[model samples]
Target: MTEGNRMFIQDKRSYSRLLLMLLLLTALVSSSTRAVVHAAVKVPDTIRVAFFINLGTKYQSLTPVATLQSANGLNLIWRDPQTGISAGTIAPGQSVRFAMDGYRALLLETTDLGAAIAVLKKVQASSNAAFVTQLTKSGKTVYQVTEGAYSTAAQASSALTKWTNAGVAAGVQTLLSARVAGPWAVEAGSYASAAEAASAAAQLGNAGLDAFAALKPQNGTLSYVVRVGQEKDATALSALQQSVAAAGFANARIPDAVEPYTSLRTDMTLNGSANKPVTLYAIPSGPSTVLRAEPAGSGGILLTERNKRTYRGSMEMSVLNQSLAVVNEVDYEQYLYSVVGAEIGSKWPLEAQKAQAVAARSYALSSGMGFQIANVVDTTTSQAYYGIGYENANATEGVNQTAGEVMTQGGKAINAVFSANSGGITADNAIEIWGGDNSFLSSAVPSPDDGPQKGLLDWYYVALPSGQTGYIRSDLLENSGQTHVSGAKYLRVTGEGTAVRSKPQVVSTVEPVARVGTGTLVVQLGKVAEYSDYSWIEDPMTPDQLLTALNKRAKSPITGPLLTLEVTKRGPSGRVTEIAANGVPVNVGAGDNLRGALNSLKSTLFSVEETGRYTIVDGNGTVREVPSQSGSLQVIGGAGTSGSLPASNAFFMDGNGNLRAVTTSPLFVFSGKGYGHGLGMSQWGAKAFAEQGYDYQYILKYYYKNVSIEKGA
Candidate 1:
């Protein structure tokens, strides 16, 4: 084609290649520049801190050490020395940080060197006794500062004294006056030549003490004396003392008691019947007290005073045992000694404190009274006194007067009870005696002061003027009054909402039989003097309604003489019949007897096959299921119109005791009798028996096996 055309093509290709190379170079340069511009900037300077004290409050002043991502970003590791509550996490933007003041130091990190310099400037501007300095002495550059350094030992001592004098508490560290050793300027190994003194000073400094040499004349030689200053000798002494105290030496100074505990004191009176004396030991500090029983060691025994006695059967003493469990009681021979000899601390010596402890122990034992104790110093005299339950156990520890007054612990109000008729005092009588219609203000029977009654109630029991042993409501009986019923016994019944009745029927039942529902959670209300038939039942209403009602009371009604029950529910039974849809006749086989077949048909079909009839009600109220027949009707076999019976069909007994065909398409009949399982009390039957004059107790016995009717608690 021609040399000229080839040359043109070659030239075009060369120019295109040159253009591509230039473009590639340009793109590479642009990319490299972009990367250099986008690379992360160098991180700046950072600061960190450590804590030196615990400031329980004032959280914001603490400076937590932080890691800096940039000037605007920070990662905080905040630690509160006071509360020991610490947290660490990344933080962005300037925000309020929390830490304990005077208890923590701030650790800071920054990317800008300028920012670090700025922070130092701020520290310098504030008079908060803080500053930053780069420690060149340490090979590694460390920022540190001198805080409140004393120039001399005398200066530090005076400073501490001034703080105490001004009531500017530095706490035990300053209060107890602890001292720390620091650099001192003193002469060591005096010599005529300054070089020798300088060498000695250098040597002492190398020994890790801040020492200096002071040249002075020593006999015939010029000697140098090396002295160390700023040593906190006081701090070491204070710390040692604290350590000793914490190691259980707080009471080591007091002499150990050599006397023995006393047990079984004589001449004690029951309920103060005869004036008696009981000796109790005073703690080492005058009026303080501790209880110990004879032959018993420490720790095992309860805090009971030695030889603290009332009487053999004193009510207060017994109650004390219940509420204030004297651990080392003379319950056994070894118990007395085991509890007495243990190490009892001096804290038990304060009489007021001990009394409070006793009262508290009593409450714990009896679950009755509530009490507290506290120490008080008479403002007028600066003397210590104890205040207990409004009075002082220590103030009058030795003032046990026989005739001062029959003082009740808290002034006995009316915590006792009296017993009376079946239902206790009627609502009318309760209102009259208690000055209010308070139902809870019921009475209890009387027993000796030392009787089994652990707590006081409003009720009591007494013999009637007529020699009746029945319950007479307590509120009606005064302190010394006597009244009784003809008879009394505890009677109760068990069942979930068990029904109590006057006549044992669903109707004519005005009151309950006594609800023994959920047989547990019982409280003794009172004894039964003579409850009428179904008189004082726990629930005097419908079974479900009564349960709902009883739960609303302040306390549940529970009495003694509880009866355990076993319940059973009756099942369905009776007889029913089925019938054919059409009155068509079917042929019977020779083996199928007519009577047997008819009996089976009686349950299988409603039609009376023997009479060819069915019992049906007509529009006019006339009964008619069978069509009028000419003569004595009977089931007869037929052909054509009648359907033939299936083969292999058999008759069996149904639940109703009726014979019928056992097939997929079968009929059911219901003619059940008896309300429930014929196991225990039958309401229907009870009514029948009651109609015959049988009493409630008689009815109970007749139905329940091996049970007796007693008064409830």
Candidate 2:
């Protein structure tokens, strides 16, 4: 038997819920706790991962919480997970659909436009990120507004002043698809009154801590304990202890024993027909319900049959704002095996896998209850944890060899963030990648892959009007060989508002002697702008397109017309440190937010430019020539992003030495290296490094500064 195979287990959406009030599905299971159970500092042996939380754009689609079954040909049982009492059994290949029993959402909708506007305003007043949707009702179009996916009609009515539907909805937000921190918590004293306990929890929460009032029942009286944060290893517990002390709750308490958690009452629909309020498990008992529910299911069982995904451990069903979360509570090492395989592939070099295993472990332990219910989620948002299917002998070897080992810095677990590729140059932890913060991640240095991976350049060396040479993109120069103009005057301005400088470069924005629009004749010039690709690049984002994206994803969206996008600052490796839109510094959240806002850049090490306007398409689906005047020019073709055009127009010069002017429309070209934030260990770089004979220790040390691979919880 494995040494420590214990059975246990963001969306960025504003669809967040109150952490403490989660998992209560009806009056069936608010069972009383005996004591506050002041826990001590200890590392967790099992990890609870919340999986298959399919919440997306509201009401587009909803993924049903599917079945859980055993695949190892072992018999499974449905049980009251809290008491570890078996309620029923699940046969091999059979399924138990965790149907919403007490879980229900009250839907609110109104067809009238005026009513919907008022309803949306009232609902959003309370600070829930609610929105209105135009959907269909009984073949007639209706404008539906909502508050929370309220579990009861009374809650829905209370959210708005008028026109509340007393109707119940089948499920919560219809998501089309499924999509951490230091593990430390501050627990205050228990109170006899739930209200007082909630007040204390809110006090801590208002202090910016993730505070939740836990129901710790005693004798038959309802007592509550104010809990904050999740489990943390001993090394990191000291900081949390001090933080709680500063937050006014000094006595340090962590979950070192049976962790109390809220339970939901879900109907175990076995074989799609019969339903019962039974806790699903294969074993009669092992551990407590909320923390670790040891399921005796066999390996390879179809936990989510619809997705053909299999998982070990037990599945716990709960709802956040009525959105269903199927949490997989599994052993920590077992989870790592799947994560290593899913992240770097099962066939990756063993040393690389080992490095990944240790990194994943450290990352997991360093995270708090990310989903508010689980320590992590089975996604890249936390880390790639695909479940049992991705587990393999190679990955298992990697995990087993590095069992309980994590990367620690200064005797504490570091964040140990890793990416697939670091392009060529790694992002500087203190500046480039996310923003100046991570001196711990300073190990992210330049990485070398097997072959050409990062940015590559190919520029045209051309002679200028004054007989000077510079590097520029070849598109800006085409030798006609047939002198379209006359002697010594053989050039046409391809782009409107093409700034003519004394010297040629990739692009120059400084004061030039003159500026020209499309077809404005000019002699050839020099250049120094860079254009490179990864052989596989995403669709280019234009200035307008990027402007829309900036508005959509930036923390402080450019409310006014978006025009110019320029990289104002960069890190050591030339990754964007700061950016400007229309000369104003953008407030895009650090890390991948800039990349995400700019239409999902491969990485943050990118360059953006006003590459002149591309093919112009107006609102009528017609491509327009360079207009003589410009009030506003919206372009299409490339991602269809919109932005403000240049203020003035460039003039075209005829062969007879006459001049004609036109509009200035420009595109923003983004080019970069790598495929992620470029921080920490590069997985692909690790593979290459491993293949080049670097051991796992060397590989890890290369990416994490002053880190020592050591064994821990």
Candidate 3:
């Protein structure tokens, strides 16, 4: 059917039929049909959204040290640990005391810098000068990393020796730049008496060494010391120390070191002049169970101090991994209102929003995800369920119009899984992503899944050399006068898949377009995509960063450095089902596991390309290949730029004026289409179908095969 013709829906006849079915059900209520009513899916009046799980993660970084307060005074309860019964109400707005009960430091030993950084950020609260030290493991080039700072050189030295047999925590303390000399001299030797040092200095002077004996205070004790080489310049001092070592003074060093600087207490975060104190949970002790807080009125909304957002209904704070995991139990319809706004978004026709309501509603009911605490999470983990702030009139109308409607197959609610985009074709949930087969879920080439680039964050439409035209995500595309949609979008051409043209032409990409369909978003009938996460591009990941993503994300985390990252297998929809890290299959049971790892790329359908790889021989004659630079680097022809490379310790300033670390360069760049796993209905496609005049029922039925919209039991 033509795109223009879709405006007319395949009507299910009339609502009179629905009314008749309801009347029939009511008439049979006292009979066996009543049991069937009880058995049929019942729409919930309320749903719990696990807003924050594993609270310390960046996925929902509202607070690392999590705590929340309601302005209208909270009705608090401390549940008993044994019986899970509330002990009683507690005073509001008062500082509650909590104890540090369980805590264990996670120390990772990995191969790459990126993975190390991922763990480093987690271990040290995003502090780059993390309370971490990377040490080379014994007999292996792999890094053994940990969280902590050195208090003393002796302590630092001890840590290196005591680093678990894993070989982490190796290093001598920096000693607060002790090697720097500001009118300071090196201590050649120390003795109990000045006469002993004087005799030693005289013998050193006889050997033409610059040395003098002097009495010095050593931590409130007197000590005779032989000092050598007076120099105010740190570089000169270092040179002199090397010379001294050559002259048999092997252990000569500076003394009386102090800490480099002071930092705010661990709980509080430092932000310029203000110290953001981390709130302590009042996980009441003794008879107290778990902390629960609610606003006074049933319909009242409470604002949390932590994220500074308002939530409807009561919030229960439960402890998970020594952090607060918050669940918001809000009215079901209210939740859908926000989900529609967050998912379908505004400015997209009301029809799309209604379709979203039905899909979201059915998915929530059938997900079977909640385990007593919450039915689903607010994150993309379930669906983008922002609270009241995300609610809009258009979305509210959609939910209200399609109230209590859900898709059912075989008299049961279907798992109405959906993604932001489809990269042109939806995936069969069972086979494409999960590697299983399901009759309820099937793939379809929705006209709206143009490509990941059609409406995503950034992209480049290029005409491939093979004469096939497709869009390339921004990351893989080179700069060629690119233009992003700023004000309004225009549909230059319309077909099964919308041809969105913000402008006639702009920058394009290199790697041939993987695939294309009706990928770009459609505005009211004919306009360019306003903002859709159809395609996405992740910045180039240094080896360290890539490995960090893989390890942090993989189920059975990869232990060593990431040498290679390649998609080993793909499902029908071109969604990745297996990825090989360093040539080994990564244990990612679900595609999202791999998705969450590599910096949370939009979807499993993606591309990984190695950039600027070069082989180099180190001073130790260790030959290895590494990426060229963090950013771009100009290369010279083999015959032109011929010189010995600098030592690894040499430093250089980068384009950003920051000192580049002693590392080679970024390894891989990732780019792809689609937002979520390519499964079930594509939200972008729904919007397209709606723009084409299809009703909510038609949209849901098309995406969910053999499904009918029916009311709850």
Alpha carbon lDDT at 108, candidate 2: 40
Q: What is the TM-score of each candidate against the true structure?
A: 0.13, 0.54, 0.51
lDDT of 1 by residue, 240-292 (tens): 33432343333212112221111111111111122222211111111111221
Q: Runs in model 2 with CA error above 4 Å?
A: 1-44, 52-66, 72-82, 102-149, 154-297, 319-323, 368-370, 435-437, 450-536, 542-544, 613-664
Model 3 residue runs over 4 Å out of place are 1-39, 52-73, 76-281, 285-292, 297-299, 303-306, 318-325, 450-532, 551-568, 579-587, 612-666
Q: Per model, how many backbone clashes are there?
A: 104, 30, 26
- Comparing 1 and 3 on lDDT, the stronger one: 3
Candidate lDDT scores, in order, read 0.25, 0.55, 0.54
Write down the RMSD of all candidates, one decimal each: 43.4, 22.7, 21.8
The residue ranges of model 1 lying beyond 4 angstroms of the native Cα positions read 1-6, 22-127, 130-231, 234-713
Question: C-alpha displacement of 611 in model 3, angstroms?
Answer: 3.8
lDDT for each residue of candidate 3 in 472-546, tens digit (9 for 90 to 100)? 333332333333232223222223323323222232443322333433331111112223366544545777877
How well does model 3 score by local distance difference test? 0.54
